[model samples]
Target chain A: MLKVNEQTRQFQSGITIGELANKYKPAADLFILNGFPVAADAAVQDGDSCTLIQKDVIPTPDEIDSFLIARHTPGIQTKIKQSTIAILGLGGLGSAVAGAMAKIGIGKMLLSDYDVVEPSNLNRQHYFIDQIGMLKTDALKANLLRMNPSISLKIIRERLTESLLPGHFSNVDVLIECFDDPVMKAATLRSVLTEMKTVAYVGSSGMAGFGDNNKIHTKMERPGIYIVGDETSEARPGMGLMAPRVGIAAHHQANQALRIILGADKGRK
Target chain B: MNITLNGNNKSIQEISSVLDLLKSLELTPETVVVELNTTIIQPDSYDTTNIAEDDWVEIIRFVGGG
Candidate 1:
């Protein structure tokens, strides 16, 4: 058997790299066997692995960043770059999560938010002073594109509702629930969990105030359902959503989403 | 009747159905997930599923704010 791009293929006797490509992927111009570039005549043996590199295709600067990213993470980068995550709210958690995902090469992102960036949001959200009056979805999109030009983004400026979620999330791999209102959060979860059973759900709960950083952690609520936060913190008049704790929870959510995409949370569900 | 709601032990009158329990806690059924013992109860069955004494119930709702 030969491992090709992480998939096992039966090794045929008396076959060369050129012959195999001719039969399977006729457009292939380069073959890498066992971590070395091989010629058309190079022989493939059982238990060997192969990678096909497209001919005459040069990676742009953004694509180069993706290459380096995947190069560092080994097996995880491919899945990360193939994932499509829908962030329902582009507030503190959603903004931070989107930025982190873009940095790590998340292939596509769908951001939804109807609210404009407020002056108060600058303290904890990922927004600049000049973006105070702009829609959060637009601002976050601009920031994310600046970070990863290769990212495929779709933005919805309207308020998200159960009726609208299906059209936006029908093909998403993961859903990050980031609404700031308890009612909206509950509503989104209620609809999405029942409608889209296959999509992974990563959410945050009780991530308010400046308290022990250790309290922020990831919890697998059920199969395909993960929550990141203290699981008990609620924002009050005095106890607020600070940057430190909110960022911690957002990182937990982002990390969990990545792990889910990479199948790292497979059996641990 | 006693039940464990969200990992917390609580004593309440026999709430009759899952819908009753949600209403007693001031929660809207559409926005909450109810787990009885270890099985998840469907949202439509909230009014039909009964809550027994000593039942372990998890009333989970989303926390707004990131």
Candidate 2:
């Protein structure tokens, strides 16, 4: 039995990937055996899984969804596609998180950022050089759409006050706090934890300078509340925000969001 | 009075409310969230929420970074 593009079929023993492609998908230009890319001449063993890709092919939404489902662990993509994540800031952490979630095909995202991209932000943020001077909300939305056009986005280009947090993110499954200001971060976390008891909250504390990568981590402050980072490294004049540490923390938050959405963080109070 | 702070047993003096605890720890109320036992203490109520002996308190302080 050989699984090709998520469909199982019986094939003659001693068949090669090229032969299988020629018989199953004649237009396939690339072949992947198991999880790694393989050449056309690669041998296709019985009970092996293979993926055939046609270059420049724009698959339909259903095809794309199927591909995602096939790539992820069993039943993971379905949960990922049904979850709604809200990011409160669009700075270094938020931008990277949004990029990760978009790549994973999150069902919807509520992104809020009041600031515009500046040259200073390019050092660590996900924005490109050309995106400078554009509102972070608009710029990030454009970038995210390019990555996954089918992702639904609701972007707000305004500073999020504590009063607005509940209303804006009332329906989201998870809320990520990526603000650069400590006051804003605390306020947002407090509001969400108190007002929106059902929504899982992932907030960042410290990802500054070039410290030990191992120091960055995810801590569940309580049930439905997670805080990522070293808990102490604040961005300052001497120790500035760098790409590697910030990205590490950002991905930690993104991963935590995924965990909450996938129900891996179940059985907590 | 003895209270659990961040999962560690600690003894403090004259800490009556969440605000007093923040003041004793030198953390500003604006930059930290106080969780008493398991209930999240709102910022406005920090001054009025009293701390009892052997209570579990988690004070999460935020830093200036994304």
Candidate 3:
């Protein structure tokens, strides 16, 4: 038995690919056997699935986007597009994480930030100069929607507290702690980890100064808590949070979030 | 008495409880999470949890930047 575009058909041994193509009378000159391109002279084996695509057929722009994304990482687009994540802060880390997740086609996101965009944020954050003075959540939502229009964004413009986390994160699959305050970060993390034990938490810790970039890492702090960065560097008076290292940490958090959602990252507790 | 604090071996005067340890370090208990002997000591329990000799304690605080 064979599957032709997911339909069952009787398997015919010794049938050349040319014979199968002729019998099917497909409009295209090429056959994709189980997602692999095959020539007309190739042998057709039993239990093979085939798809016929016209030679030199150009895919639409949107189709090309899907094809390229799926080609690079097969079976990830669908799953990523169905997963929901909640980003607790919308600063450099959260903003970049949101953009990265949206680009990967995450289904939905819950973004919370109370501050407005400032000129200082342009160095590493995902906002443009024109967006300065706009609420971080609104700006981030606009930016994410612009990239992936179909994404579901739940924007919260108030300061997040331990009390408010559970209510807002009821439907999210994972929690991302992107706050700039160590106090708030600890508070939010403790609240989420204790209240939402089932949800995975990806956080940033030590992304500061122009220190060793290689030191930045994603480590499973506990069973459900994952922290990215060196876990040592602190922003000091002379040292500052530059773009390169910050982006690295943000992407690390974002990547952790993606892998957790896809079941690719199982933390060692 | 001696205890391992945040991976560093520290020599401290005898302390009655986790709260005493935080007070000696000048750290407000509200700002950090304490892990004693590989177990997280909750903030509410810090006052009552006694500090034992050679205890492995991790004092984790938040990083202020993203």
Arranged by TM-score with the best first, the candidates are 2, 3, 1
> Deviation in angstroms for A213 in model 1?
0.5
Residue A66's lDDT within candidate 3 is 60
Which residue pairs collide in model 2, if any? none
Q: Write the candidate numbers in order of decreasing lDDT.
A: 2, 1, 3
lDDT by residue (tens digit), candidate 1, A90-159: 8889999999998887889999999999998988999999998999989999999887777889998987
Q: Between candidates 1 and 2, which one is better according to DockQ? A: 2
Candidate 3 local lDDT, A125-233, one digit each (tens): 8898999999999998988877767668888888877788888885677889898888777777777556676778887888988888899998887766788989878
Evaluated against the true chain A, what TM-score does chain A of model 3 have? 0.73
Clashes of each: 2, 0, 1
- Model 2 residue runs over 4 Å out of place are A12-52, A267-269, B15-17, B37-39, B45-56
Error of 2 at A208 (Å): 0.5
Among these predictions, the greatest TM-score belongs to 2
The candidates' DockQ values read: 0.38, 0.81, 0.51
Q: Residue A10 of model 3: what lDDT?
A: 83
